[model samples]
Target: MTDYFWDFDGTLYDTYRGMVKSFVIACTESGFKVESDQVYKSMRRTSLHQTFAIFLKNVDFKKKQRIVTRYETVEKSEQTNDRPFKGAAEVCKWVIEQNGRNFLVTHRNKSALNMLKRDQFTSLFTGCVTSENNFPRKPNPASLNFLCDQYQVDKDNSFMVGDRALDIEAAHKAGIKGILFDPDDIIFVETVPDKRIKSLLKIIV
Candidate 1:
């Protein structure tokens, strides 16, 4: 059976709204004005860290840390705003029904699991690797490698599904197929994934 590795933000959950809003608020509170649309676009094009660099350019490291901390604080407090995209739960269930295993690999800390539990999705996963795992973030495959080794996963039949090129890169580095889930067709990445789908329901186990 095929195994799946999932990304939380933007992949399983439609979280960019809350994340972008919190980031904007944090930046504004820190005396930096930023456009939400631009921030969203940058985040889609790259990553949260890179997007912060784009907006927080010329800022000192300490101030950048403060804004990031503020963003995280606001985001965590407003976690109720994050929700799984349509078919996210269904797709995970489908994988299980097909005798496939589903695992989560996310940069989010334990909060990722908390949100999953809140959404009643915790039982759907065989395992998860979160920020607390301390594996290098994607496009590094350290976490994926760890999961594969720990679970005795068949890399040839496993896939990593995420919304960013870094996810695909990590999957490749881990010797697994990558599926790019770009529901809005807004992401542009040079790395070619094993497959690309605009919807979660399109995933074939």
Candidate 2:
């Protein structure tokens, strides 16, 4: 069985609304005004810090973190439109049935895992590693190494699936095949799985 590493936001749960809400709250409360479209566009692939600065410019990192932390709580308990993507449950179940371990990796603060716990996603993953209460976030290999050491996941047989270039880069760096999430977003993965698909269902199932 191939061990799987997955991303949380956008990969499984549809937290775009919550993300938008949290970002708006964080930026505005910190100091600046953020237009909805700008925020929306930033959501496509922006890093959390960059996203924060786009709205909460000039804010100290520590204070900015507070804004983001508070917003995370709101997104957790105040879930309005949260949902697992189409066939997410099925894909997860299939992985389990195939005797594969599924790890949820996200740049989201670990506090957001509380939302997953409240939302019942904790039951779905073998392990959920978030950027908050853990090692450096994705695009970085520290977290990935932590996961490998913790789970004894086979790097050769293992794989990563994410919508970001960093995900593939990390997978390659960690010696795992990088299976990109967007079939339409072709990239230069010339030596690995180098495969891209639109849906996790297509790859995992």
Please report how far candidate 1 places residue 22 from its true position, in Å: 0.4
lDDT of 2 by residue, 158-202 (tens): 877776667777788788877777534543444345677788788
TM-score of each: 0.96, 0.78
The TM-score measured for candidate 1 stands at 0.96
Q: After superposition, how far is residue 44 of candidate 2 from its true place, in Å?
A: 2.9
Q: What stretches of model 2 exceed 4 Å from their correct place?
A: 25-31, 58-70, 183-193
Tens digits of per-residue lDDT, candidate 1, 76-127, equal 8878989998999999999999899999999889999999999999999999
* Reference-based lDDT, residue 73, model 1: 94
Total clashing residue pairs per candidate?
0, 0
